[model samples]
Target chain A: MSFKTTVITILIYFYAACGATAQEPTNYSAKNGLPTNHVYDVQEDKDGVMWFATNRGLVKFDGKNFKAFTIKEGLPNNDVWELYLDGKKRLWVFSKSRYQSYVLNDSIYNFATSDGKTISPAPIYEVDNALWLRAGYYKFDGAEFKVQNDYATFYHGGSQQVFQKHGLNAEAAAVSYDFIFNQYFLIKDGELWFLNADGTVLKK
Target chain B: MSRRDSQSAYRFGNLFILINDKGIIVINTIAHTLKHIAFKDLNIFIQPFDTNQKCVFVNNTYQISVPNYLLIFNAGFELIEKHPFPEALEIHHAFKDSRGHIWACSFKKGIFLYTAAQLRTLYYLKGKK
Candidate 1:
C-alpha cells in the first residue's frame, strides 16, 4: 500500500475510535429493584449514598443495590416530591401531599411547629442557620420547628408596567428575583429582560 | 404559555440561569451580558421547583438537563460536549455525585447513571507486517 493511503487509513481509524468512546448511561428501573419508576428527585448524603424520592416511596442506592422505604417505614406519603440535603446532612423530604419531613439516622420524621401544629410546605430558604418559609422563618428547636422573627425579607413588588414599558408583554412573561443582586429577570417569547430593583430596564 | 407551564431563574455564582418552555438564558449579573440557547424540542414537564435541580455546577462546568440530552457548557457559556439520551427517556434533572458519576432522573423511565472516564488518551498499536 502507498504511504499516502496508509496515513489516510490511520486517520479514519482514529476518528472512528473517538466516536466509539462517547459515554453511554446505564438505566435502573423497577425491573432492577427500584420501588417504582416515577422518581421525582435525587440527592446524595454525606456518606456518598444516593437517595431518590419516588412516587411509591423514597429509595436508597448504595452503588450496588436499591433499598426502598415507604409509609410503613415512616414516610408521610409514598408520593415524594423533592429531596434536599442540608448542611448537617439531614435529608429533607417533601411529599406530594405537601407534608415536609426530614430523615435523620435513617428515620423519617414529619416537621411540626412547637405547638404541635403541622407546618405547611413552602419554598424553604436557609438564612443564618434558620429555615425561612414564604410565610415566615422557623428554626428547629431540637424536636420541632419554632417561629423566628429575624428572617430575611424577599421582594414581592408589582413590576408589570416596568416590563410593558420595555416592549415586553408583562402578561406573557415569567419573572424571578435575585435577592443578593436585587435584580429582576423576566423571560418572554424567547427573550430575557433584566431590570434593576427600582424597575428600570437594564438589558434586553 | 399555560398557567401551569413551569419557569424559573437561579443564581449560580456570578451568573443567573433562566429557564422556560422556550429555552434557557444565562445572564452574567455583574457584566450585564446575556446568552440564550433555544431548545429544539421543548420539555414542558419541567416543574417550577424542579429548576433548582435542572443545572448543576461541577469541576467548573455546568451540566444542564434539557429534553433528552445532557449538555455540558464551560464557565464562559460555550457548549463543550453534548450527551444524547434515548428518545423515550425525558431527563428531569441531572446531578453529579462526589465520585464524578452523573445521575439523571427521568420522567417515566428510571434513573440513568453515567460514569465518565477520567482520562481519554489515544494509542496506536502496530501490527506485524
Candidate 2:
C-alpha cells in the first residue's frame, strides 16, 4: 500500500474504535424476569438496590436479578405510578387511582389518614425533619399519618405576587417552591429564574 | 396548553431544572450560575430519582410519546451522558445508581440498563464521523 493509504487506513481504524464504545442499551423485560413491560418510574434505595414501579407490580432490581411485588405481596394495586424514598429510608409507592403505600422491612402496607382513609398521592414535603403530604393535610409521624388542618400556612404567602412584581407574567410562568431550600424556581419565556423566598433574584 | 405540556421545575440538591417548550434550563442556586439547552422539535420532561439524590433524568421525546433520547445530569447540573433509544420505547423516567449504571424505565418496553463504560464511550462518539 502507498504511504498515504496506510495513514488513512490507520486513522479510520482509530475512529471506528472510538465510535464503537457506545453500545446499544441492554433490554430487560418479562422475558428477563421483569414483572411486566410497562414501567412507570425507577428509584434507588440507600443500599443501591433499584426499584421500578410498573403496570403489573413494583419490581426490585439488585443489578443482576429482578423481583416483583404485587397485590398478593401487599401492594395496593398492580398498577404503580410513582415511587418516593423518604428521609427515614422507607419506600413510598403511589399506585393508580391515588392509592398510596409504603414498604418497610420488605413488606407493603396501605398509607392511610388518621381516620383510616387512604391518603391520596401528593407532593411529599419535609418540614422540621418530618414528612408531610401537601394534599389532604396529612402528616406522617414516622408511625402513622395524622391530620394537620393548618398545613397551608407553611407555604410562603404572596409568592405569586412576587413573580408579578418582578415583571413576570405569573399566569404564564411555571413556578415551584423548594421547601427545603426556601427558594422559588420560575420558568418564563424559555428562561429559568431563581429567587429567594423574599423575592430577591438569586440567579437568572 | 394542558398541564402536562406546561413547564415544570424539579430540584436536585442546589440545582434547579426547569423544563419548558423550548428545552431545559438548569440553575445552580449556590453558584448563581445558569445553563440552558434548546432541543429543537422535541418535548422534554424531568424526574429526579430521589429526594436526596443529586442526579436528574431527562426524557426527550417527539410528539410527546415517541422516545427520542435520554440525558442524565449530575449534581453540578452538568450533562453526564446522552443516549438515543428506539422510538417504540416510551421511557417515562430514569435513575443512575451508585455503580454509575443508568436504569431507564419505559412505558411498555420494560427497563434498559446502560453501564458506565457504555456511557463514557458516547463522549468520544459525538460530532460527525
Candidate 3:
C-alpha cells in the first residue's frame, strides 16, 4: 500500500491493541498525557504497571492513566535507547542523545556533552545484575561516551539515523528476543521469512 | 525472490543445522513450501523462536510448538526430548511461573497464566483502557 496508508493503518492497529489486552485500563497518550511520537522503550514495574520511553518523555501507564516524566520534571534524557526493570524493579535506561540513567529511587544520572562532537548510541539490554549496552562508536562505561579520536562506527550519525528510521511499525520491523536462540531477529525489510525460530508461515 | 519463484512450487530458502532441542546436529530449512522439498534424516517440522519471520524445521523425535504463553524457550533448540509447557493456541513460548501454573498468551487473548492440569483459565490480561 501507499506509505501514508500504511502509517495510518499502523496507528489504527496500535490503538486497537491498546484496549484489547487490558479490559479496564485508563490510558495516557499524546492527547491527554505524554507527548512525542518516538516510543523508544517500554518496561513493566514490579506493581505490574507499564512505562513507555518516548522521544520527549517517560510515560508511566498504570492500567488506568498515564503519568509522563520528562527532563524538566526529572528524566535523564529525551532519546532513550532501552528501558530495563531490574530485579529490584528499579528503572534503568539507555540513551542516544546524552549520557543519563534513571534509578528506582526516582533519581536521575546525568552526564555532560563537553566535546563539540556528537556521539551515536546503540542497542541496550539488561542481563543479570549489570547492564550491557553498546554505543554506536563503542561500549560506554556510562560516563561521557565521546567520539573516537580518529574515526569509528559509533561516531557515525548518518548511518545511525538510517538504522533508527527503518520502519519499527512494519511487521518486518518487529523484534523478539529469544533467550533460547540467543539472537535478536526480525524480518528484513522486503524479505519474506518462511520458517523462523518461532514458527513457519507460507505466503500465498 | 518471489519474482524468481513465482511459478515454482518452492523457492530459494535458508538452512541452519540445529542440534534439535535435544542434541542431534540435524539439518533444518526455512522455506515457503516444504511439501515439494526433499531432505535426509528428517524428523518433525517445528519452528524455533528467531526474531525474523522465517521459521525452521529442525527435527522430529517429539516435535515442539509454543501455541501458548510468552517466556523462555530459554535453553535453545533441541529435538531429542519433549519438555512440557502450556498448551498454546498459537503460542511462541510459555512459563509455569510461581504458582505451578502455565501462563500462555494468544493472538486472541492477550495473556493468561492458567490453572494446574490445563483445565481452566485463572488470570488473563484485561484489554481495555
lDDT of 2 by residue, A1-204 (tens): 999999999999986875664556789998888878888778778777889888888888877888889989988788776677766777788764334688766788775567566544544555445766545556777566777644344354567667767988777876776655666777787677788877898777
Residue B34 error, candidate 1, Å: 2.9
DockQ of each: 0.36, 0.41, 0.04
- How much native contact recovery, as a fraction, does model 1 achieve? 0.49
The CAPRI category of model 1 is acceptable
The digit string of per-residue lDDT tens for model 3 on B1-129 reads 010111111001122222212122211232331121111233333444332111112121112222221212212433232223334344433333333343332333233334443322112222221
The TM-scores, one per candidate, come to 0.65, 0.65, 0.38
TM-score of 2: 0.65
DockQ score, prediction 3:
0.04
> Per-residue CA lDDT of candidate 3, range A1-204, in tens?
999999999999985674344322222345554565345444555565566656666666554566666777655566554455544556766555555566554556655333534434333323333333333332224465443332333133222333344433433342222222222233345343332222323231
Better of 1 and 2 by lDDT: 1
Candidate 3 chain A TM is: 0.46
| Model 1: number of backbone collisions | 0
Clashing residue pairs in candidate 1 (N, C-alpha, C atoms within 3 angstroms) = none
- How many residue pairs clash in each candidate at the backbone level? 0, 0, 46
Alpha-carbon runs more than 4 Å astray in model 1: A1-25, A86-89, A112-157, A161-168, A172-174, A179-182, A187-204, B1-5, B28-32, B39-53, B117-129
Query: By lDDT, highest first, what's the ranking?
Result: 1, 2, 3
Residue B46, model 2, lDDT: 37
Per-residue lDDT of A86-172 in model 1, one digit per residue for the tens? 645677886544346888777888866554444434444443444433323456655656655332343533465556567677667
